[model samples]
Target: MKQLYDQRISCPHCGHHIFVSLDASEGDQDYYEDCAACCNPIHLNMHIDYAINKLELRVDADDEQVF
Candidate 1:
């Protein structure tokens, strides 16, 4: 099945809303983005399965991993 999966994630640095898309065909399993409000880097850990059309998202850097 084909779908356009997306999620709204908040930036941990500035609490900004970010829109992320799940591109299974392009192998976009995991990625990161920047916060528009604070100009800080955001780390995104995503897992997408095309077969079941399931998407899991984890945003921001770890407590020990500084930006």
Candidate 2:
């Protein structure tokens, strides 16, 4: 399996599309990265579902995203 996966997400600040690199080996993670378009912070959350064998991601602004 690939350790890194490319995820496409929209920047909550400027509504621009951006691609982020996520590491699957970490299992679960939360981090912030600057948006390439808006130059604002983008919150990213990722989780691994071993049962379905898939990686789930959530992107938000400075607040937490509700499922």
Candidate 3:
């Protein structure tokens, strides 16, 4: 598996497409990045599935609530 990779995601606030760099070497991670278009903080949750050799990314706005 590649330690470093890039994924394209849409900003939850502005819906603008952007590329984000991810490092699988760090394992699962939770971070935030400012959206290029909307300038809102984007919550990024990364999960690595070693069994399936897959990386899953969840993108959302920081202010989102889960019900």
Pairs clashing within candidate 2:
none
Instruction: Point out the higher-scoring one by TM-score: 2 or 3.
Output: 3
Residue 25 in candidate 1 has what lDDT? Answer: 62
Give the deviation of candidate 3 from the true structure as CA RMSD.
1.6
Q: Write the per-residue lDDT of candidate 1 for residues 1-67, one digit (tens) a residue.
A: 4556677888898788878766656555566687777877888876666678766677865546558
Global Cα lDDT for candidate 3: 0.92
lDDT of each: 0.71, 0.86, 0.92
How would you encode candidate 3's per-residue C-alpha lDDT over 1-67 as one tens digit per residue? Answer: 8899988999998899999999999999999998888888999999999999999999988785789
lDDT of model 2 at position 24: 95
Say which prediction, candidate 1 or candidate 2, comes out ahead on lDDT.
Answer: 2
In model 1, what is the error at residue 33, expressed in angstroms? Answer: 0.6
Candidate 3 is scored at a TM of: 0.90
- Runs off by more than 4 Å, candidate 1: 50-52, 63-67
Clashing pairs in 3: none
Worst 10 residues of 3 by lDDT: 57-66
TM-score of each: 0.67, 0.83, 0.90
